[model samples]
Target: MLSSINNIFGNSKKKKTDAIQSAVVAYSIRNGKLTVLNEVPEQSVKNVQAETNGLVLTQGFHKIGGSFFYFEEPGLYFFSFPFQKNSLRIVVGKDAIENALLISNTIIRGNKDDEQSLKHLKKEVLDRFLVLTCTYACIFVQHILNETGIKSRLVMTLTAEEENQYNDGHTLLEVYDTAIKKYVLVDIDKKCVFESDNGEKMDLLSFTGAIKNEAKIRIVSAAGFPKLDWAGFCAVDSGFNFQFIEQMFCYDEQQQLNLYKRICNLPVIMADNKYFSVSSATEVKNSWKNKLNFLPVEEFRQKFYPL
Candidate 1:
């Protein structure tokens, strides 16, 4: 999301740069008064409308930040002014036209203290402003593509090292790929095998028997894993199924072959074969609890006081 926002606003080519740099402003009005607004310099004022009352007012952009007054109705009036030299604008209206003018003058021509007050007012306007403009381009696109929909699914493969090194700072694609390849094979609406990083490999039947007999398996790593390094199988049911395979091979061909053989001998149950790479088991467990939003008290006890 951050990357997408940056991409839309960060390009530096002359044409795209000009388009982004072009000012975008916002505004809103309520209860027969203008309340929230933004003022921009260089670019044109694209559109304006009232959100609550359905009253509409339209105007063009001015190069300088200044004041403009107009009458809307009998005993009612509108006033527009810029907040800063090149920032947003604030529009205010009132039934008492004379009082409104006095306040507007005090704000626009007042002393340094008054200027400070106006700056605060401008900040408030900016903080609360909402977009009142609607473009026909978006409407047209929505209308044309109303019937079509997009669906996608990903099956990732990650390594043990990658699993234990989890960080949201990485791209979604990177994380997805890492999770699928290392721990579980994700598929749509189908039961798939889950692999664990247990010290020794065993067949599925033996693995299930051991897990059923022991009830719990201990995850131990003498070489500490990175913070947030954990792995799990997540199955998403969203009406789409796609499959892709990724293989990892190293320069040491003999070592790679031996590793492959070991993996091939592993158990098949989703729970029995799972392993997490984490710097501290307790911390990782707590983090997962907070993220997943529900931790059984029994699980909590096991996390803090594991036998």
Candidate 2:
């Protein structure tokens, strides 16, 4: 059934007023079956001839030549090869020249149903979607990291969010969380940090401080705004950390301005100010390695280890 459809509408050609031509290569699937339809009209044939004549004449040949006679019609036409059960549709118009050339080539090459062609198309679509998602996520994560003044490598986890909907596949998120000993607490005014294993309190000095030398940290939020939050953090980590702090805290040019500011803002043993920090670096790193065991880390090992 699909073969028949492809035979009928797999290729279409159309002509334009300027004598240029356009062609459509399309196929449809329905009810687990595929069909190809002819979408070209008759007018395209005349256009094809005109274009061919123009090209040939431009080369300084008075006599029109080479497939010039094939553009007699001005609309769509259907044709079937000898011993072929399926019929193909071609629209002839000003656009017919290019369309004709393409259809002719397809006929000669015999690649209409090549496995490589299908695979190429599928890969193109997948690559496009992946690029779009990654770009958006990167920007969003950077922004959040800058605002929070946290420094940590942001790695994504592929975890299923919801079940298949309307037969579509599940949704996933690239995520990272701090180790079990690492804990974080935040308030409206300032982000408080604490360590579960050490019982020590460390205030979040800046976004860069959060992830700079530290191994990892857990991201916590209500269930919504996944893309926005992730993009914010990624933006900061990518480069905007110090710039963000400068905008929020103005200071004169000093060699140790950032460090000075952090120390100045440190919270005393005051009430109503909460603090959040990680428990232990070793425990956090181990937990993350266990959770992300499926990642491609062989390259990481090679880079970190020379021999």
Regions more than 4 Å wrong, model 2: 1-210, 213-307
TM-score of 1: 0.16
Report the C-alpha lDDT of model 1 over 99-152, residue by residue, as the tens digit. Answer: 122112211111122223423443433322211101111121122122122111
Q: How much is the lDDT of residue 112 in candidate 2?
A: 21
The lowest-lDDT stretch of 10 consecutive residues in candidate 1 is: 167-176
Report the C-alpha displacement of residue 190, candidate 2, in angstroms: 26
- Residue 172: error of model 1 in Å? 52
**Error at 92, model 2, angstroms:** 37
Could you say which candidate leads in TM-score?
1
